[model samples]
Target chain A: MKQLTFDVAVIGGGPAGLAAALAAKEQGATRVLIIERNLELGGILQQCIHHGFGLHRFKQELTGPEYAQRFIDMVCRTDIEVMLETMVLEITNQKQIYAINQTQGMMQIDAKAIILAMGCRERTRGALRIPGTRPAGVFTAGAAQRFVNIDGYIPGKRAVILGSGDIGLIMARRFTLEGAEVKAVVEILPYAAGLTRNVVQCLDDYGIPLILQSTITCIHGKERIEGVTIAQVDQDWNPIAGTERDISCDTLLLSVGLIPENELSSQVGIQLDPVTNGPAVDSNLMTSIPGIFACGNVLHVHDLVDFVSQEAETAGCAAAAWASEKQYSSTRIIASTGKPGPCCPTSDSIPFDGVANECCATWGSTQIIIKPGNNIRYVVPQRICPDKKTTLYLRVRKPDQDVSINVGELKRMKHTFIRPSEMIKINLTPELLARHQSDYLDIHVVKEMVHHD
Target chain B: MIKTVICTVCPLSCEVELTISATNEIEKIMHNRCPRGKSYATTEHIAPRRTLTTTVHIEGAIHSMLPVRTYEPIPKELLHQVMQETANINVTSPIKMGDIIVRDILGTGVNLIATRSM
Candidate 1:
């Protein structure tokens, strides 16, 4: 086995890895390496051909590949090393990596810092457990996207989307443009799980029905997809008895949700937030293992790629700083040594029953724990440094009009409306956080009194 | 007549309401968080436009499909027709990003260009 050394090793050569590597290089970290599993560097962005990315970062609309190309071009201009078609098998707390590729049979990489940017995977049919015979046409919205956009093969003619997420909404339009009929986009929630722009442009533009509060109860097929049985559900998501209706379609695409690809994260025993299903890191994006950092979808699934780039860059800069100063000593990858950080960061604000794996490790003794309160689903960067200026990404549990979000006496901003689909950002300046005296910060959405003006 | 236009300029999705006079002119605009929504409502009322984004078949490329989009938003009604025209178009690889795929597509005066190099 050939052994190589790099200052920083970024896993997964997607938008996250590309941006992170670029930032690390810009931050004076030489010999940065990116390991990609695919033949190309642009991760899912290659298959995401439609525009709407880079709105925040570039202030202009850009296609996924275009957004990715800008970062790729920047990395190309630098001396950053790239290892394509390489699959990282394991990562150790000692900052060593074991990866394999066709060209390199087995290689070991010694790095001062590691960045996880593997991104997220789409939720599939097996996860849904929809009662049905094994069908050939059933596919995840992302899988269908790759097939059509990259492989140049349309999955089916008439399709029914199970989730009204951005992927499903985007694919609904894509299928329509490709001369396929998108019969309906069924979502269990009363509102769309995706952005309002996607719902308007993708479905409303094409006159595709977005059936809210409805879900596919059963999928019927023997060889290929024949049709699906959809039903309206109650508040608890239980299907109503007489609301079942059959929609005959050749394809049933599931855009249920996304899960952070944390298989390798767990392999290295990185602490994960139960709500985000990603790494539990501090304000600096540093995971439990000192030198290991996470960003982009690997940290939390972002609604936009622009946010992903912003986050990955932060992780990159932090990784570069870590590589410069190797100050960490011990490895507490074992959960028994975990600090049991703040129980669950979700709505249930109670501590765990002394379960080690259930809680994440606290970054420091003085790190303020951010807890979700009221209607807030979860807040990323579960821990924060009081003196640092930090931005906390959060999501609401439901949609509401005219609400003020309070961040532990740090700040309060009024919003015209808030929804689960749109992520809310709370900026905590050091001056504002100086007013916060508590060791833990509770973020909650509070209803303001109606103004008579 | 009143029209509620959802501003797609940003993720805020401000619901802008526009009041149109009988002379087919906008009399008042309300509820927009920014000036972009005002222009969006005016343009949407007279002639709604949309940027068409889709894939076209490409030969001699690493990937068989090439993503293309309009340089600027064309009339919203021309989207389906433009897509139909785009389906018949194919290009060879080694094309640069921003290269014109179709000039004056459907005579809508909007050029379809490649968004990424192949």
Candidate 2:
């Protein structure tokens, strides 16, 4: 058994963790540690060898490995410590981490602040519950990608992808380029689950058919995947009778969705947003359990790695601040002048009550709640501290053109189009926060219809 | 002549319509949101290019295969040929990132460089 302490401890050494650790070190965190389960620092990016990454951050189209290398190089130059092949079994609410590794049998890490960057995992065939026999040829799109790109082995000669996700679309092209036939990409939704560019460059460019409003009803195979039975779904998502058709294929790749890795967060009693499937945090990316921050896919599944880096930087800087004893006192205002209403008395001084106190004691700043109204799926940083500007990332329930995103009269921004696949970002400055009239900030989308003769 | 191209410059994926003269020169572009979209439409209409990313066989490395991609996008028409050429190639381990695996692929003057170190 070994014991250690750090100014900041970051879980998961993927893009998010890598960015966070670097930012924390740069922010003057004396001792920062990154724990990675993988043998290498780069996570899924190692297997994601395709281009189209780093467009926003670097202004150049780069492969996932290249994008990751840039950060890995920067991390190499810093004094940040990384624990590779270390699995964090649990994290306590007090910022204590219990982990295990082959080199270090058992270890306990006590940190002043923690950053959760566990990233996410792909949804599998078992999760989808597709009626089928246990087969060897079945694989998730990511698994197939790893097999082909990293291991130099083709999963199958012919394939049928279950979801039109970005990975599935990219895999479809990869298979085709490797001399395999991609039969079809069947998506349950009418619209694609991936970026529009993926639909065009991966499927449309290759002449692959994208079947919408359809799903695989059954998978037929005993030893290996022989084929699949796909069917069109009605408005209610029930398979319509007589619309079922069997397509012969050697492989079935599931690209349904991704779930954030938050078992540790749940175990630590961190409140999670049901919609985002991640911990609900405040403006500083601090989770319900103060001093514990979260970012990247573990916060919410993002379409771009560039956004993940941006978010991780925020968490890293905040964690460093907490560790350096500079915590958020600067942003906290007097309770009397707090927007919405006067702050309630501190919970520690008063008797335990049913209502939770929403005010911070150090500066008496009231926490304002943010709620999604209509068409908007959910908003991150579910709560905001009005002292500084905060960025809210959200997703729409449906696609629309000529629409305005209204934040309860506090802020409004017009967009040419908004889609569920693309996450929207809105910045609420301190000036906008000053006009807050309610405890709850409502965000809704209002679409303007266009007419053509 | 008119060609409709979906700009892959960004996720916006604007559908840009390119009007070309009979002499194969781009005359006008419409419906693009940004300058990059206009350039993408023109280049894609005239001579589409795509960066080819794939794995190549590696010996004595952490992994059996190493990911590689062309330093620059080659001609779209040369993708299949270049892929075929790259398929039969193998490299030894101890390779560094940015190491060129294949030079002047398909006479496109684009070199296939290693994206990872092994």
Interface RMSD of each: 1.1, 0.9
Largest lDDT belongs to which candidate? 2
- Candidate 2 chain A: 10-residue stretch with minimal lDDT: A347-356
Candidate 1: pairs in clash: none
> TM-scores of all models?
0.94, 0.94
Tens-digit lDDT track for model 1 on B1-118? 9889887777777889998889988999999988888898789888999888888999998889998899999999888888888888889999888999999998888899998889
Candidate 1 — which residues are off by over 4 angstroms?
A326-365
Report the CAPRI category for model 1. Answer: medium
Model 1 residue A116 CA deviation (Å) reads 0.5
Range of the 10 consecutive residues with the lowest summed lDDT in candidate 1 chain A: A351-360
Please report how far candidate 1 places residue B12 from its true position, in Å.
Answer: 1.4
DockQ numbers for every candidate? 0.74, 0.84
Clashes of 1: 0
